[model samples]
Target: MNSFTQYIQQLFANEVGGLFAAEPAPLREARQKSMDFFLAHGLPTRKMENWRQCPIDGLVQSDYRMQREADPYRPVEEYFQCQVRNLATQMFPFLNGWFVHPDAPLTKSANGVITGSVAAAVKQCPELILPYLTTTHADKADRGLVALNEALFNDGLFIYIPANVKVEEPLQLVSMINTDDNLLINNHNVIVLGENASLSFVHCDDSIKYGKTLINNVTEVHLAPNAVMHYYKTENKDADSLLVNHLFVRQQENSEWVSNVVTFNAGYIHNAIHLDLDEPFAHANLYGLYLVDKSQVVDNQVFVAHNAPDCSSYQMYKGIADDSARANFNGHIVVRQDSQRTQAYQTNRNMALTDEAVVTTHPFLEIYADDVKCSHGATVGQLNEDAMFYLRSRGIGERTARMLLMYAFANEVTDKVTIDSLRERLANMVERRLSGELTLCDQCRLHTSDGKVLIFDVDPDKI
Candidate 1:
C-alpha cells in the first residue's frame, strides 16, 4: 500500500475517539460497532467505484491530525456572528470539528425542529437520535475511510424536521478546520426530514493554517413522503488540505430533494453524492459548480437510483478550470425494471480557461425499464473565442470579459439555488475565488431592488 493508506491505517489502528467516547449505552454500542467497521475496512483508493477518479493517495500518505484543544485562531467567527445577526434562522457553529458555543439560543417554539451538534444531541436526546446516526459505509461495506470517520469523528451537526412543518429559515451548519495538529480529521452529519416537511440546509467548510491535513466527512439525508429538502454546500479548504465528502440521500414517495454543490477552493477534493428514490413519484434535482485554479484537483461522482415508478431526476453540473487545475464530473443514473415511466436527465458541461487546465466528464444512463425517458451527455471545451472577441469589441478587458463569461456559464446552476441570499453568497464566492479574494467584505455585495439587504436566511426553517 502507498504511504497515505499506511498513514490512515496507523491513525485508526485500534480505536475511535472524540464525540463517540462519551455517548450513553445504546449509542455507545453503535459507535463501537461503527468503529470496528472502520478498523476493518480503512480508507478508500482509486480501486473503489466511487473513488475511481479521485484517488486518496495524498491523504493516506499523511498522519491523522487533530485540532488544538483550545481555540488559537478565529477565521470563521465573524462569518458565523454575521450570520447569526443577519440570518433569521437557527444556527449551529462548529470550529475545528468541535462545537464552540454550546449555549447558542434555539427557537424552541418553532415547531418540531431539532438542531444541534450530533454528539450533543445524542447525549441530551438519545432516544430521538438513535435511529438516524448510522455511517455512510452501511452499503459500501468496505469503505475504509468512512469507517475510520465513524471511529474518530469529533463533532457533527444533526437536524430533523417533523411532518408537515415548513421551516421558512434556512438552517446553517458551518464547519471550520484548524490545522493545529498534523493528523487526519473525520467529521460526519446526519439529517432527516419527515413527511410533507420543507427544510433548507447549507454546509460551509473552511479552514485555517497551512499544513498537510485530511478531512473525511460523511452525511446522510432522508426525505419522507411528500417532504421537500434543499441542500447547498461550499468547500474552501486550504491548498494543503485533502477533503473527501460523501453524501447519501433517500427519498420517499412524492418527496422532492434538491442539492447544489459548489467547490471553489481546495488542494484536492472528492465529492460523492448518492440519491435513492425508493418510492413512487420521488424527484431529485442536482446541480454542481466547481472553479479550480493553480494545480488543484476536484472530482465529483453522483449516482441516482430509480427504484420506483414514475420518478423524475435531473442533474446539471458545470466546471471551470484554470492554470493547471484538473476536474472530473461523473454522473450515473440507473432505472430498474420496476421503475416504469421514469424520467431522468443528466448533463455535464466544462470549460478550460487555460490551455493547461484539464476536465473529464462522464455522464451515463443505465436503464432496465422499457418505458423510461433517460438521457445523459457531457461537453468539454475552451471559452467561446467568438464571445470573447464580441465582448472585447465592446471595450471590456480580456480578463474582465473572461470572468464575466465564466460567471454567466456558472450562473445556470447558481440560479437554481432558489434562496436569494444563498444565490448572492454563492455568486460572491465564485467571484472572490476567480479574483483570489479570501475576505467576504472584499467580495461584491448583492442586493434586491427594494434596498432590503438579503442575508442568508439562517433560520430557513423558521420561515
Candidate 2:
C-alpha cells in the first residue's frame, strides 16, 4: 500500500477503539465495515476511469494531521459573521474536524427540530439518526472516498426536521479550517426530513489560514413522503487547500428536492452529488455555478437514479475558467427498468477566458426503460464576439461589456436560487470574483487599500 493509505489505516486503528466505546454497537459495526471497504479499494489514482480527469496525487502525498479537537482560543463569530442581510439563521460552525458551538454542541428548535454535532446527536437521539446514518448510498460499490469518510469522520452537522413541521428561517452551517498546521479533516453529516416536513439549509466551507490542508466531507439526506427540502452549498477556500465534497439524497413519493452549488475560488475542488428517486412523483433540481482563476481546478460530478415511475430530474451547470484554471463536469442519469415515464435532462456549459484555460464536460444517460425521456448535452467556448461587438457599438466600454456579459452568463444560474438574500449575496460575490476584487484577504475580513482592479481587455486575435 502507498504511504498515504497506510497512514490513514494507522489513524483509524488508533482512533476506532475509542469511537467504538463511545458509540452504540450498530454504529461501531458500521464504522468497521466501512474501514474494511476503504482498505480493500485503497486510494484512487488517475488510472481509474471515474477519477482520470482529476488527479489528487499531490493531496495524498502531503503531510497532514488528522485529529478531533476544538480550539478554545478562537471564537466562532470571529470566522463566520452573518453576511446575508435580513435572513435570520441558526448558525453551526465546524473548525477543522470538530464542531464548535457558540455555547453548547447541540440545540433544538421550538418545533422539535434538532441541529447540532453528529457525534452528540448519536448519543442524545440514536433512534432519530441511527437508521439513516451511513445508509443512503450503501449499495454503491466504488465509493472508496465515501467509505473513508465513514471510517474517519469524528464530528459534523446533524439536522432533523420532524413530521409536519416547517422551518421559516434557514439553517446555516459553516466549516472553516484556520489552524497553522497541515491538517486532514474528514467530516460526515446526516440530515433527515420527516413526512410533510420542509427546511431550507445553507452550508458554507471556507479557509482562514490558507495552510496546506485536505478536507473530505460527506453528507446524507433522507426525505420522507411528501417532504420538501432546499439545500445550498458555497465553497470559498484559499489557493493552498484541497477539498472533496460528497452529497447523497434519497427521496420518497411526491417529495421535492432542490439544491444549488456555488464555487467562487479554491485550489482544487471536487464535488460529487447523487440523487435517488426511489418513489413515484418525485422531483429534483440540481444547479451549479463556478468561477475559477489562476491554477485552480474545479470538478463537479452528478449522478441521478430514477428508480420509480413518474419521476423527473434536471441538472444545469455553468462555469468560467481564466488564466491556466481548469474546470470539469460529469453528469450521469440512470433510468431503471421499472422507472417508466421518467424524464431527465442535463446540460453543462463553460467559457474559457484564456488560451491555456481548460474545460472538460461529459453528460451521459443510461436508460433501461423504453418509456423514459432523457436528453444530455455539453458546450465549451469563448465569449461571443458578435454579442461583444453589439454591446460595444452601443457605447459600452470593452471592459464593462465583458464584465456585463460574464455576469449575465453566471446570473442565469444564480437567478434560479429561491432565496432572495442568498441570491443577492451570490450576485455580488460573483461580480467581485470576475472583476478580480475578491481575494484571500476577504476571507479573513482583512481589508487593504492596494486599490488594484483587473480590467478585461478584449483580444481581437482570440475573438
Candidate 3:
C-alpha cells in the first residue's frame, strides 16, 4: 500500500473505537462495513473507467491530517461575516470540517421541519434516519470513495421537511476551509422531502484563505410523491484545493426536481450526479455552468435512470476552458425494459479559448423500451464567428462583444435558479466573473473570493 493508504489505515485503527462510541448500533455497523470495503480497495484511480479522465494521483501522494477536535478560533465575526447583501437566507456555517456558530446546531421550524447537524440528528433521532442513509450506494461506480467518506466523515447537514409544509426562506449551507496544514475532510448530508412538501435549498462551498485540502463529500436527496424541491450549488474555492462531490437523488411519483451547479473557481473539481425516477410522471432537470482557466480542472459525471413509464429527464451542461485548463463531461441515460414512453435528452457544449485547452465529452443513451424517445449530442469548438462579427458591426468593442457572448452562454443556466433574491445576486456575480473585474468592489468582501467586475467602455446590453 502507498503512504496515503497506510496513513489512513493507521488513523482509523487509532480512532475507530472512539469514532462510533456514541452512535447507535446500526450506524456503527454501517461504518464498519464501509471500513471493510475501504480497506479492501483504496482511493479511486485512473484504472476505473468512471475516473479515467480525472486523476487523483497528486491527492493520494500528499500527506493529510484529520481534525480530531472542534477548535472555535477567536474573532469569528471578523472572518466569517462575508455574505451577499439583500439576499435572504438562513445560514448554517462550517469551518475547518466542523459546524460552527453561536446559535444552536439544530433548529425546528413552526411547521415541524428540522434543519441541523447530522451528528445531532444521529444523537436525537437515529431511527428516523436509518432508512435513508447510504441506501443507494450499492450501484454507484465509485464505491471505494463513498465507503471512505462514510467511514470517516466528521459532520454534515440534515434537512427534513414535513408533508404539505413549505419553507419561505432558503436554507444555505456554507462550508469554508481555513488551515495552513494539508488536510482531508469528509461531509455526508441527507435531505428528505415528504409527500406534498416544498423547499428551496442552496449549498455553497468556498475557501476563506489558505489550504491544500482534499474534500470528499456525498449528499443524498429523497423526494416523495407530489413533492417539489429546488436545489442549487455554488462552488468557489481557492486554487490549492481539490473538491470531490457525489450527489444521489430518488424521485417518486409526480415529483419535480431542479438543480443548477455553478463553479466559478477551484483548482480541481469533480462532480458526480445520479438520479432515479422510481415512479411515473416524475420530472428531473440537471443544469451546470463551469468557467475555468489557468491550469484548473473540472470534471462532471451525470447518470439518470428511468425505471417507470412516462418519466422525463433533461441534462444540459456548458463550460469555457482557457489557457491550459481541462474540462470533461460524461452523461448517461438508461431506460429500463418496462419503461415505455420515457422522454430523455442530453446535450453538452463547450468553448476552448486556446489550443492548449482540453475538453472531453461523452453522451450515451441505453434504451430497452422500443417506444421511448431519447436523443444525445455534444459539441466542442470556439465562439461563433458570425455572432461576434454581428456585434462588432453594431459598434460594440471587440473585448466587450466577446465578454457578452460568454455571459449570455452562462446566463442560460444561471437563469434556472428559482429563488428570486439568490438569482439576482448570482446574475451580478456571473457578470463580474466574465468581466474579470471583481476586485474593484470595496463594500463586498466577496470580491476577495476569486473573480472580478465589468466596467464596459460601451454597454453591450444596449447593443
Query: What is the lDDT ranking, best to worst?
Result: 2, 3, 1
Single out the weakest 10-residue window by summed lDDT for candidate 1: 439-448
In model 3, the runs with Cα more than 4 Å from the true position are 73-78, 134-141, 438-463
User: For candidate 3, which ten residues in a row score worst on lDDT?
Assistant: 439-448
Question: Which candidate has the top score in lDDT?
Answer: 2
Best first by TM-score, ranked: 2, 3, 1
lDDT (CA) for every model shown?
A: 0.74, 0.83, 0.80
Q: Report the lDDT of model 1 for residue 324.
A: 93
Candidate 3 lDDT, 1-463, residue by residue in tens: 7787788787777666776577777777777777777777777788877788877765554488888755664435454553465568787777778777565677777888988888778877676676766353734445677888887877888899989987788888888776777878888888999999988888888875557888989989999999988889888877878888989899999999998998887678999898999999999999998888888889989999999999999888988888898898999999999999999998899989899999889898999998988988899999889999999999998999998899888888889887776776666677877777542222222222344432223222432
Give the Cα error of residue 456 in candidate 3, in Å: 19
Question: Candidate 1's error at 346, in angstroms?
Answer: 0.6
Instruction: Please report the TM-score between candidate 2 and the true structure.
Output: 0.93
Candidate 1 lDDT tens digits, 1-463: 5555455455544343542445666656655676666555556657766666667644555455665243543333333343423345455666666665635422234587887767667666667666766433555754676666665666677787889999888887766554456646666787888999999887877664566777788888889999999999877766778888888899999999999999887689988898999999999999999988888889999999999999999999999988999899989999999999999999999998778988888887889999999888899988899999999999999988888788789878888998877786677667656656643222212222344443443222320
